[model samples]
Target: MRLWQRTMIRLARSRTITDFMHASRLMRPFSSRFVGGGDAGQAVATAQELAGEGIAASLFYLGEYVDSEKLVRENVDALLKAIPAMAAAGLPLHVSVDPTQIGSVLSWSLCRENAFRLARAVAEVARGGSHPARPALMLDMEDAGVNRETLQLYFTLRENDLPAAVTIQSYLHRSLDDLRDLAAEGAFVRLVKGAFAESPAIAHTVRSARNASFKAAVDVLFSQRARERGVYPALGTHDHRMIDYAGMVAQANGWRRQDWEIEMLYGVRPGYQRRLVQQGFRVRLYLPFGRSWWPYSIRRVGETPRNLAFVLRSMAGAAG
Candidate 1:
């Protein structure tokens, strides 16, 4: 990571900054730009609007790194309870699951049970939705630490005949091998250029290398053999270069736009997302909602210097 990003990350973790962000209402516009809303009801409303534009949604209830049993249950139950209503909207949808937030970091069995319950709920409701591509309960890949366990949870869900999907961080050196293995299983893989910071030894710390890794990942995920196995690749990126590269590869491999998907963040690059939809590509926005919004909002700013500058300028305007 660059010094500025490292510095911002450290700042994001501090008590003063966290508390300020949590309490300030000035972040409302910025939050709405990227976040779904402060609760599930509002999130569904946002998803409905996106649906009218020919896009879909993957709803994420944001609360990560839970430290207590009560918090874990709260996080799990919140999403579990929201599933049926979210499905009722008749939109192509997914509930994003972060294992660490639901006990993977502390207890494996507990996390598995929580995840299984959520995935099973999705499996039941997905059949009733109108969209042909079955909605999946997506397991988000957090840091490198818990990736294996997340993938295991996904397999367990699948083995039991539940609807499940998993994410792959292309920035990781081990991702190509992981993608190869997942392809054989016909796994639903959401591919991203990873957001977490890691050692340069294990992750591509620079953008060029990470971008290359991402393209290379697309080739593996969209390969003829993988497609034959019914592997579904959701390209989770906003980069035009990556999008174009994936489009080219998909066309060359004789895949239609509807066969795969382009996943973008709810608030980022709205114009580009619509353009892709108009071009007949299936697009889904990752929509996060909940009271625990500070952690997510700060990371978006830190992800790019331009985003950081924009937020800072917004803050200045708010102060004025």
Candidate 2:
């Protein structure tokens, strides 16, 4: 990673900094840009609006590395409620959850149980929606430290024949193998150019390297073998070049517009998202909502450190 990105990643992990940012309203404007809103209702409304323009949305309740079981249960219950509500609005009921926030830290068994529970709910909703795409309990791939457990949980979900998806971060050296393995299982995957900062020994340390890995990973995701297994890959990126590359690969594999999907943050690269949709590509907006937006927003800025300057300028403008 570049020095700035590394610094930003470290800053994102600082509890002291997180507390300060959450305590003040200075970050609210910045958070609002990325987060859909403070509740499921707002997220559903945003999805409803996007649906009018031929786009889909994923509802992500935001919390991670939660300290208490009470908070974990709250997150679980909130997601359970959000699923049907989104489906009821005629929107695709996709939800992303972080294992750490959902009892992984408290008890692996508890986490697994909750995940299976949510996946069952998703399966039921998906059967009723009749949307071409399946309703998925998307498991967000968090920091490398938590990845092993997250991935295991996803496999567990799939083993149960539940509706679910898993995210793969391309920066990690092991992702290509993981992608290949998941492909055989007919996994639904969202591929992300990873955002966490880690040592060069285990992760690509530069953007160019990360993008290179991302490209390689996409090949595995779009290969004929993956296609034969009913694997569906979602390219989660704002980089037009990468998106184009994926389109080319999908075409080479004889895949259609709806065979795979593209995911972008709700407010990031709006025009690019629409252009893809116009060209007959499936798109899903990653819409996060909750009272606690600090971690998610910080990760966004950390993913691209230059965003920090934009946030600072916005805060300054608000002050003036």
Candidate 3:
């Protein structure tokens, strides 16, 4: 990572920076530009709006690192409510969640119970025909620290017959292996270039290498073995090059647009998303909502230097 990106990542994780940004009215507009809203109702409404534009959405309630059961329960409750709301709105939606946000950091048992509850709720919602497409319950991958536990939880969900999905970071060296294993299980997977700052020891620290890994991983996901086994892949990227490459790969493999999906953040590359949809590609927007958007917003800004203007405005607001 570049020095500026590394610095921004550290700041993104800092509570001091989070407080400053959250308090700055100047940041609200930028936040709303990316974040869906502050609650489930607003998020579902946003999803409905996107659906009207022929875009599917993956709704994420943005909070993580829960150290309390109360917070975990609250997260589950919100998801339970959101599932039905998205269905009622007739929006094509996938629900993404952080395991730690629901109690994975507290205890494995707590996390397991909470995950099962949310998955069961989603299953029930699907059965009711509220979400006819049977939108998946996806577990958003965190840093390397929780990788094993997150994967365990995902497989456990599948073992119990829950239609679950897990994310794999292409930057991580272990991701290739994880992809292979997930493919063997016919599990749904989302491939991202990774967002967290990490040591070069475990993750690809170079941009070119990471991009290469991403394409290689995509190839593995769409390999004949994986496809025949019914392993679905979701390509999460906004890079035009990567997007075009994915389309080329699909075409070469004679895969239909519905066989795989291109996932992008809700606010990033809107025009590209529209163009992809117009070209008969399946696209899903990652829509994050909730009051705990500070950390998430900071991470988004950290990932793209172009977003630094919002941070500068926030800092200026604080100084003034």
Q: Estimate each model's TM-score.
A: 0.95, 0.95, 0.93
Best by lDDT: 2
lDDT of 1: 0.85
* Model with the higher lDDT, candidate 1 or 2: 2
Query: Please, what is the whole-model Cα lDDT of each candidate in the order they appear?
Result: 0.85, 0.86, 0.84
Task: Residues 142-192, candidate 2: write the lDDT tens digits.
Answer: 878878888898998888888889999999999998999899999999999
- Which has the better lDDT: candidate 2, or candidate 3? 2
* Candidate 3 steric clashes: 0
Task: Name the lDDT of candidate 3.
Answer: 0.84
Clashing pairs in 2: 1-205
lDDT of 3 by residue, 35-138 (tens): 99889999998888888888889888877888778888888888878988887888754799998888988898888898888888778777777454446889
Query: TM-score of model 1 relative to the true fold?
Result: 0.95
* Alpha-carbon runs more than 4 Å astray in model 1: 128-132
RMSD vs true structure, all candidates: 1.6, 1.6, 2.2
> Which sequence of candidate numbers ranks them by TM-score, best first?
1, 2, 3
